[model samples]
Target: MSVLMSAFATLVGGLADLLQPLFHAGSAAAAIILFTACVRLAVHPLSRAAARGQKARTKLAPQIAELRKKHGKDPERMQKALMELHAKENVSPLAGCLPSLAQIPAFFLMYHLFSSREIGGEPNELLGHSLFAAPLGHRWADALTGDGVFTGAGLVYVALFAIVAAVATFSFRMTKRQMAAAPTPAAPEGPDGRPLPGMGAMAKVMPLMSFGTLLTVAVVPLAAGLYMVTSTTWAAVERYFLYREMWAAGAAPKASGAARGAGGAEAA
Candidate 1:
């Protein structure tokens, strides 16, 4: 555990130190966005898994409904049936978690990279040096952009932070709605198949999480914050839409991504 933790720390410190330079121009917000994007881009496997889960879920909805009707009270049989169905279909059962689950590590890495102090005096994993020099601060700064969102930025930034907070509650609803709005190809399913990683209560909490994430980005350098803003908007868009394209690809989706696609990709 210590080694893993140390390695994790290294990954993070390396990211922050490396990318710290990119904050020179635009703002650390920009670098943050870049870092977010780079991380997101690398998480294609999780994205693929999530899309697969989504496809499988849409395909399995009817079966799930039937299972609920037939075995709603028989927990053991329901479990057995569900497992059998999933096994037959080659489903991961938890596959819909691809996008969301993928993001945890990236978030940790971001925190690590964003918060690390001068490790080796080398620019860690970050790409460029600071243009205006927004010296790094606390980890919370990374989470909220180091207090970047002042009241006067715009109704947009103001609204964005609120939206990010409410994203768990509201934005994801729109996302899910959009996802449902777009038709997908059929998939095989288990008898009790529903969307893998159903977004029930989680839906309500996501916007809060989104808000927290954006807030984290807001406190950092303007560049990082700006990147956060752009990436957040982009991510919300992609989360709603990317499934269609990724589903077409087999196990690993290509790296094509929007700003948030790359940035938010890791947050998947």
Candidate 2:
């Protein structure tokens, strides 16, 4: 573990060195952002695969609904049938989670790298780095207590909060749009033909979860907050394009059907 930490420290130091000319005192912070980009780039293929999986699952929703109706009374049978269907279709239901899960290690590394005072038995020099007046190793609370909110470090936090809020808003809207555009699952109706218990509430709450990143950015070390900001922004943009592609793909057949109906009417 110490060896791994040492290597990661070296990587960050190397990136800081490369960025020093441009970023000056904030080079370490810039290096964190660049490291984040590299991490996201490495996981891009998984993200694409996840997108394809999501499209496949969307296409399979109707069949899944049918299975749900057929096996609604038998929980075990339903589970077995769902597994079989996914296997036959070569789709992993959990694929959408890969890109997010893959990033956890990188985030934790940044958090620990900045939080620690020593690395491999030596003083951690990276702690001395700052993004303007904000120390990369410091938290928002530290800045607030030491210099107050209007001071340089506090203003840095303010800027970060603003950016996070904007990104979260973008993500929230995108999520709502996707949910609105998605085909309603022909869920197995309960006695009242309503969605399953808690499902509706969950749907309503999920979109707002995007704003949770604000709380995250506020609490973590500045270095990790930088990573979070970069990553969250990347995710919002990537999701927009991927969801747009999926929407277009899903609409093509409906468009063709409409054209066919119009042609039939003209012939008649």
Candidate 3:
């Protein structure tokens, strides 16, 4: 673990050194963004795989729901049937998890890099870098309460928080769109005749989980916050392009068939 941390810190430090001359005092902050972007790009294949899994599940949703409705009374049967359906579709419930799961190690490396006062058993100089007047290693809360509150560092944190808020908003809207487009399962009824937990509602609520990022950014080193901002923004844009391609590709067949039908009608 120590060896890995040392190696990662060295890599990040080297990257920062290269970037240091480009920025005024925010070179570390810029370095964090660059480093994060590089890591995210390296994991692009995992993101693509995860996106494919999500697309598969979305396409198979109707059939899965039918299985659920058919076996609603028997939990064990429903589970087995769902498993069979997934197998047939070549989709795994864990498909959407791969991209995120793959990121855990990178996240830990960033966390340790920011949290540790020393890296590779030497004096850590990254902390000496700042975004504006705020040190990259300084926490938002510490900056707000200390003399930094009166300086440009305070504004830096405020700007970061704003970016996080924007990301959360975009995330919520994307999730809501996904939930709206997803096929809803036939919900079971309770004894009172009220419908039980609706899958649609659960899906919509899941996006709210993103708000936690704001809280996380508030307490971490500013460098990590910068990392989160750049990484998440990149993810949002990447998903947009990927989904656009998927939608266009999926629509092509239907579009061609519709065009042929119209031509036939015109001929007739």
lDDT of each: 0.52, 0.87, 0.74
Put down candidate 3 lDDT per residue, 1-268, tens digits, no spaces. 7788788878877877888788756667777888888888988887887778778877876776576568777777777777777788777667667777777777768887878888778877777878887887888887878756556778888887788889888877776655444444334333222246775466546889777788888888887877778888888777776666555555676689899999999999
Candidate 2 at 140: error in angstroms?
0.4
Residue-by-residue lDDT tens digits, candidate 1, 1-268? 3354456546534555565576434344444555667766776567666667667756765676677678877767877877877777777767666656666665554444444443345444332333233333332333334445352333335654565665445455655453443343233333343333545555445435655667565555433444455556656666656654534432232334355587887888
Q: Which ten residues in a row have the lowest lDDT in candidate 1?
A: 181-190
TM-score, cand. 3: 0.80
lDDT of 2 by residue, 189-216 (tens): 2322235777777778989999999998
Q: Name the lDDT of candidate 3.
A: 0.74
Q: State the local distance difference test value for candidate 2.
A: 0.87
TM-score for candidate 2: 0.87
Models sorted by TM-score, best on top? 2, 3, 1
Runs in model 3 deviating more than 4 A are: 148-150, 186-204, 245-268
RMSD (Cα, Å) for all candidates, in order, is: 12.2, 4.6, 5.8
Worst 10-residue lDDT window, candidate 2: 185-194
